[model samples]
Target: MRATEVAMALGEPDIHKRVEVVRTRLKRLIDKGWLAEHQRGQFSIVEGLNGAALNGAAADH
Candidate 1:
């Protein structure tokens, strides 16, 4: 999501600050190779991870 969208979703009144934080965190993740930046302001998960495994801890009893 875009920084604006992230700020809105977070209900942060200071959009600029929130956007900066989002950008910083995204950059860190990207640098660590945890997320792939699709473009200047877009990102996607890298391949090879199992979605079911990732969600397994939240499974309903």
Candidate 2:
């Protein structure tokens, strides 16, 4: 999702924080080979695979 989309979903008021949060998380996932960035502002999981994006964070539960 775009940063704006993330921000809206998260109700994050700061645009810069929204971009930073999304970019940082996406970059980490890409680096781990869990996701592939298709374009400058787009990403998806590697093909032929399915998994949750939850780390050991709040979403893990």
The 10 consecutive residues of candidate 2 with the worst lDDT sum are: 52-61
In candidate 1, which residue ranges exceed 4 Å CA deviation?
Answer: 51-61
Q: How far is candidate 2 from the true structure (C-alpha RMSD, Å)?
A: 5.5
Q: Give Cα distance to truth, residue 20, candidate 2, Å.
A: 1.0
lDDT of 1 by residue, 1-61 (tens): 7666766677766557778887787777666556667888886655553433333321211
The prediction achieving the highest TM-score against the true structure is 1
Per-residue lDDT of candidate 2, residues 11-55 (tens digit): 777678666887787788677667677877777667754555556
TM-score of each: 0.60, 0.58
Whole-model Cα lDDT of every candidate shown, in order: 0.63, 0.66
